[model samples]
Target: MRISFSKREHDLLERIRSGDEKAMERIYNEYRNEFIGWGVENHSISEQDALDHYQDTITIFFEKVMNGTLQEIESSVKTYLFGIGKNRILQQFQKENTRLRHEEGVHEHYRFLAEKELNDIYTSAIEKTAGMFSLLGEKCKEILKLFYFDKKSMTEIASVMNFKSEGVARTSKKRCLEKIREEMTKERNGG
Candidate 1:
């Protein structure tokens, strides 16, 4: 909607355009608090941010007036200033959102790196454990293969391995794991 400026507002703009510093100051002073309050209440902007945007808004208004770009107004000066202030707040929010996204991207990159490193460590440990498996006696190897790769219960393992009982199968599995751990520790200590 195109609304013509009031005579007084038109005169104020003309005076500002003519380098009338007092007229500019009057406009600035008149709108500063109101703009800040409106920004804080309506836009959820903090007081300090509202004040900064208000200053920027006034500067933009003054610049337009001086540059002959703001010759006429379709709204009240307060509306114009508030419009500028709202745009500034939106720009600020966009900037903040962009920064937050960048930070999240950085964090995601680091998380990926950490996950890859952890997977590498786990892969290396599995490779080392496979190598250690080769050093086991045939009986221990058969017992571990039955319990793990064959997915056998302790009763089934004992029956297949000809152990006396499930307890013997459990003991054998425990001993196999302990031997692997001992060998791994020795390799780590450069033994």
Candidate 2:
């Protein structure tokens, strides 16, 4: 059976989509603990594991909705959260091979859906790293910010950063980018 959201919940979802932090906080508070409890009871996940899954599910939901990928929900936000939480728990189960007895039918369905959804979230997250040049050393940061965010050419960036030549600026940018990629990979792998 399909679940429905009340008008207030629907409004809250809209607020979350619009980047209202308070609405997002309210949504998190309303569902996070309940989902954690559900995860612990049904999936045999530790309390900490349940909390991590809950936070990750909420983060994924927020990212998708804010990025305009997940437009609207037919289910109440609570039901949607539970669905995401179920999938996250199944993912943990598959990875850990914990001997937990979940209802086979529901587990199978959620596992399939969660794998796809999490893959999309992961992809989007990786793509977001292309902007990491902004976090490099101050000189590199300024040069890259001017080149990318400010739409400056190599010549312009060199002049802005007071480099001797465009070649030097270009090489610095390349090395900085490599450093950013290394950092991003380290972050993704939790190093």
Candidate 3:
């Protein structure tokens, strides 16, 4: 690769080669923001992604220069660096796409198993509640079945159960529910 390396760039490269850390830092600061902005504006990458890619790009460039692998470039240093960053970003996207494709079936299968397990738990809890429910007094059972299973209004329940008013039926339903809750709690506590 042939880089139209400027005299300043040549000097910078020489300084870096001579183990000048300040020269490397200077080069890093010089292009960091520009690279990030370019990545965001042109590639639609997040700022953090751009920053990370830029760091990687800089690292790769430093390694190549230090190890004598990248002897020359076919363009300007900025262009070369951007090219590396773009390739890395595209590679990441490709990897994410491949991962999603592989995970789709696994995800669906797990979701199905999760739903089945939830349903089984719900059925078990309902069966337990029903068992406890049968042990209640006939009056309590009738009132609960009418209000819950039959979806009867408070006024309707009051009329059916011969309560004084809708308010009395409401209170009775509340008390029945409280009794069921207490029973369930006792059962849970191994009583």
Specify the highest-TM-score model's number: 2
Could you give candidate 2's per-residue lDDT for residues 1-191 as a string of tens digits? Answer: 65567889878767876679999998889887788888889988899989988887888788766655566667877878889888867766435422224234445666753577665644444454445644566887777656754567898778878889999989999987777667757766889
Candidate 2 ranges beyond 4 A from true positions: 1-4, 93-191
For model 3, how big is the CA root-mean-square deviation? 26.7
Measured on C-alpha atoms, candidate 1 has an lDDT of 0.80
TM-score of each: 0.48, 0.51, 0.47
Q: How close is candidate 1 to the true structure, as a TM-score?
A: 0.48
Q: For residues 1-191, write the lDDT of model 3, one tens digit per residue.
A: 45577888878877775558998899899899999999899989899989988887887787666655665666777888888988988887434543345346545765653476665654445556578788878989989877765567899889999999999999988888788677656777899
lDDT per model vs. reference? 0.80, 0.73, 0.77
Q: Which ten residues in a row have the lowest lDDT in candidate 1?
A: 93-102
Candidate 1 residue 31 Cα shift, in angstroms, is 0.8
Q: Count of backbone clashes for each model?
A: 0, 0, 0
Evaluation by lDDT, superior candidate among 1 and 3? 1
1 or 3, greater by TM-score: 1
**Alpha-carbon error at 75 in model 1, in Å?**
0.9
